[model samples]
Target: MKNKFSEESIDFIKDHINDDPAEIMLQSRKFPELPMRDIVVQIASRQKAKNKLPEWFGNYELILPPKQNLEQASSEITAKFKARFVEGDSLVDLTGGTGVDTCYLSRKMGSTVYVEPSEELCAVSKHNFEVLGANIEVQNSTAEEILNHNLVQSDWIFIDPSRRDNAENRVYALEDCVPNVIVLEERLLNSAKNVLIKASPMLDIKKTLQQFSSCYKVQIVAVDNEVRELLLYLRKDNDEEADIEAWNISDKREEELFSFKYSYEESCGFDIEEPQKYLYEPNAALMKAGAYKLIASKFGIQKLHPNTHLYTSDELIESFPGKKLVIKEVLSPAKKEIKKRVKNGTANVIVRNFPMGANEIKKKIGLKDGGEEFMIFCETEAVGLRAIWCERV
Candidate 1:
C-alpha cells in the first residue's frame, strides 16, 4: 500500500470532505505540505461510492482503489446478486481486481482466495479486506499461473476477465478478453465443480453459448431497467440446452424474473391483435434475453404485430414482468388528430417496430418530452400505423 497519510493531510481531507475535487486542486497552492492529489482522489471516490458502495462509503478507515479500478469493480447491488449463486465450502475469485465481489462472495463460503495479477491492486485489496474484516487470502499472481501451479482448489470458481486489451481498448469477445476464458475453459471446469464467468453486457448471448459447450445457463441482469451484466454458468460435465434467465432489479418495485429455454422460445406461438385496454412493454433484461414469443405465451397476451414486441390485453396482468400502461385512446398518426387527444402538448414518447424514430415523431407532431401521459407509436397488423395514448397503471 502507499505510505500512510500524514496527520496534517488527514485533517485537511476531513475539513474539505464535501468540497469539489476540481476546486480543491485549484486551491492546492494553499496547502504546500499536504498531499493534495491523494486527498482529492479520496473525496472524489467517496462521492462515487455514495450510491455504488454505500457500506464502504460509510466506513472512513477503508481505503478506496484508484478511479480506473473502482470503475471496473462491481457495485454492492451486483456483488450481492452474485452471492446468491455461491453454494460450496470453498470459493476462488480468479481475477479479483478491487475485491468488491470477493468480499461479498466470501460471506457464504468457509474458505475463499482472491488472485490478481497487479501487485498494486493486490496490496490495496489486501489492506482493504483486512480493514473490512473479510476472511480472504490475497494472492499476487495471474489466473494462469495459479491454475498451472495447482496452488488452490475450490468447489466454485468465479472469474471476471479484464475487458480491455494491452492497448487499453475495450474488447467484448470471449477470446479477446484477458486470460481468454475460451482458451482456459477446460482447465477451469476441471478445477472446480461449477464455474461462473462474468462477461460484458454487450456480448452476444447466442454467440457466447456456441463458444462454451459446457455452459448450461445464461443470466442477463439489469438494474432499474438498464441491462448491466451477462453471466455464464458452466458445470463440470453437463451439456444440456442452456437455460436463459432475465432478471431486472429495481428499487421502485419487486424484481422481475423470466426464464426460458432456447428450444421452447423457437416453438412457441403467439396471437396477433389490435390495440386493447392495456399495453405491455418488456423490460431491458427480457428484451436482451430475446423472450419475445415465450413471454406472450406464458402471460396469455396478444402481440400487436408479428415483428413488434409490444403486447396488449383486455384486462391488466399485474404480474407481467414489464411496464403496464392503460390505453386511453388510439389516434391516427396525423398532427391534427394527435392535437385533439393530447391537449397538454407533452408526453413520454416511445417507438418500436416503426419507421420513424421517437425524436422525429416528436418534432413532426409538435410535442415536448415529459408528462404523466405516454404516446406509443407502432405498426400493427390490423392497422398500418397508429399512435397509442396511454397512462401508467
Candidate 2:
C-alpha cells in the first residue's frame, strides 16, 4: 500500500533496516504500521543476539557474486546513461530507486522528472536531489501512474525492470515479465526518442533482444574482474534497421562489437604472439564482448599467447585499459622454485588458473599476505608460471 510513515520515520527505518536490518526486521513485525516500532519489532521477530555497537558492525561478511549478476543499473549504467544526456532535452527515470540514475541525468538535462511510486522513496530522492542542487521534479508515482498524470514528452526515458535473483526463475522475455519492458518500451518511445532499459545480465540476452524492436545497443559492464550489469538502448521507430551493437565496459576502456558471443567465437581461432616487455590485459568489458581477435587487431596490439588473453609490446601503451604487468621474474610453482624466487623473504601472492587455493599456494612457499612485493601464481596463455615481486602490469 501507500506509505503511512512520515519522511523522517521512513528514512530512519530504512537506514536501520539496511544497515543492521536484522534489528529492524524483528522490530517491524511487532508494530507493523509505526516505522519506529516496526524497527524493533522486526529485529526481535527474527532472532536476538546479545550484542552492542562495534561487534554488531563487525558482523559483516563477504559473498561472492555470480558471474554477470546485477550488471544492470550499476555505476556503469549511470555513467553510460549520463554520457547520453545533453543540455536541452527532458529526461524521465520511471523506476527511480535511490535516484542514482536520476541524479546523473539531472546534472546534464535541461529538466528531469523522477517518478518513484513509494512516498518513502520519493522523500529520499527529493532530499538527495536538493542536496545535489539538481533541477529535477520528484513525483510520488509509478511509471504507469505517471503516464496518466503528466505530459512527460521526454527526450529520454530510463526503465530498470527488476529481475528475480534466482537464475532459474524462468523469465524468457519482455512480454513475460512485470511491467513488460518490451511493451513498456513501445508505449514510452511513442513520446520519447530514446529509451534505455536495464535488464539482468544473467538472463538470456539474446532472447530479450529478439522480443524487442528498435534496439540499437547493448552494454555489458564488468567491475574489477566480474561482469555485473547490462543495458539495452532502444529507439522510437520500432525500426528493424537500427544496428544491434554490443558494448563491453570496464574502467580501462569501452569496446563495441557488431555481433555477439556465438558468432564472434565461431569466426576465428585466436592467434597469439610472444609477449613483449609491456603486456596489456583486456579490460572487463572488451573481454565480455568476446570479439577477442577484432579488438586486438583494431587496437594494434599483439596477443601474448594464443590461449592467453594478454597483449604486449616493447613500447609503452597507455591506451589499453587493462593492467600493464612488467614481468620481472618467473619461476615454477614448486616449493623449491617458489622459495628460490622469494628467497629474500618478500613477495605478494595470487593464484590464477590454478587448482590450488591461494592459502595453500602461499603456505607452500612460506609467503605471508602483507608486504610490498607481489606474487602471482597464474597460468597464462604461454603456459603455467609463478611470478614474484610483480606489480600491477
Candidate 3:
C-alpha cells in the first residue's frame, strides 16, 4: 500500500520523535488509525537523512521510502557528485527506485524523466519532487521496456540496477542485477550520447572494464573513509582508455580528488623504502581505484612495499589525499616488543594485510585499544610483518 500521512499521524510522529526508535515503536498502539509502521519508518528515515541528506531532510513535506529503499538510496553528497558530470536539455534515469539521484541530477538539465517500475516509489518521488521545486516527469516502466519503446533520444541516460535478488541476498555481477545493464548495454548506448551507470563499490573495476568495449571514465567515490559507489561513464563512439577519478567526499563543504590513467599505473615503476619520517595511507577511494604505484610516483613518495599501500616520505606533504602521521617508531609485532614500545599499555590498533586481527593483536600484545597513539600492523617485502607506532598529524 502507498504510504499516506494524515494530519493527526504527522502530529503524533513529531510529538514522539525520540533518539531511541525501538523504544518509541513500543507505543505504536496509541495511534491505531495511522500507519504506525510507516510513521516509524518516516521518523527513522528522517533521522538518518538529517545527517546523510541535510538539504532534503530540512523540508517539512519531505517523504521517505521504506527502510530497504532508504538504505539503498544514495546520499545527497554522492547524488550531486554524479550530477556534475551531466548537463543537457534532457536526461532519463532508469531504475529510479527512490529517485535520490534523479532529484539532484534533474536540477542540471532542462527536462528529466524518472522511470521506476514500482508505482509506490514513483508516487512518493513525484510528491517529494514537487515539494523540492523540481520539474520532471515520472514514468512507471522497466528500463528494458522503456529502451525498446522507440523512445526519443536524450543527451544522457542513467541506470542504477537493484543489487539484491528476490530473497534479499546480495548479487554483485552486472548480469545478475535486475534490469541487467550488461544485457542492455547496446540498447542503452543507442538511446543516448552518454550513459552513466552506478554500481556497488565492492565491484571490481578491472573486471567491469572488461565488460564494455570502451569507457570514458571510472569514478571511485567514498565518504568519511568508507568506499561508497563506483560510477562508470560511457560514450557511444569513444574508444579512448578510461580515466580514473578517486574522490574522498568526506566533508560536506570540501572534497579531495585524485585522477590518474590506468596505463600510467601499469607501466610505471615505484621505489620502496624502509619506514620514513612520515607515513601516508591512501583514502578508501584511492585504494579502491587501485592506483597504488601512481600515487607514489606522482607525489614523489616512497612505498613501504609493493603489496602494502602505505606510503612514506621524509618531507611532510599536508595536501596528501589520506591520513598523514609522523612515524614515532617501527617495531616488531612480537608481544614483548609491542609491550615495550607502547606507552600506558593502550593505543588505537589497525590491522592491514596481516594474519592477526586488531583485537587479537591487542590481546596478544597485552595492550588496550583507544588512545591518541596509533598502532598499525602491515606486511612488507623486506620484513614479513612489522608494526608502526605513530600519532596523527
- Specify the highest-lDDT model's number: 1
lDDT tens per residue, model 2, 1-393: 122335555455435543565554555566555655434432331122212122222221211111222123346244544456334478888887656567676677888989877676677567656655778898887787666555678888878765542464645355555457665665777768888876665655556667665776677655555656567778866655333344444445554233444454556554565545765656565565556676566556776545556666677766655556676665666788667766675676655456688888777668887655566665555654545335564
Per-residue lDDT tens digits of candidate 3, residues 1-393? 344577887786677655567766897787677787777888887787777788877765778886678777899888988888899999999988888899899999999999999999989998888888899899988898898886748999999989899899988778888879988988999999999999999888988998976578999999877888999999898888899999998554368899988899999889999888999999999999989998898889998888889989999998899989888988888888878877589888887788889988877777787767888899876777999998898
Best prediction by TM-score: 1
- Taking all chains together, each candidate's TM-score versus the true structure is 0.95, 0.63, 0.94
Instruction: Rank by lDDT, highest first.
Output: 1, 3, 2
> Model 1: which residue pairs collide?
none
Let me know the TM-score candidate 3 reaches against the reference structure: 0.94
Error of 2 at 83 (Å): 5.1
Poorest 10 consecutive residues of model 2 by lDDT? 59-68
User: Which regions of candidate 2 are displaced past 4 Å?
Assistant: 1-88, 127-133, 145-152, 164-178, 200-213, 221-228, 238-270, 274-276, 343-389
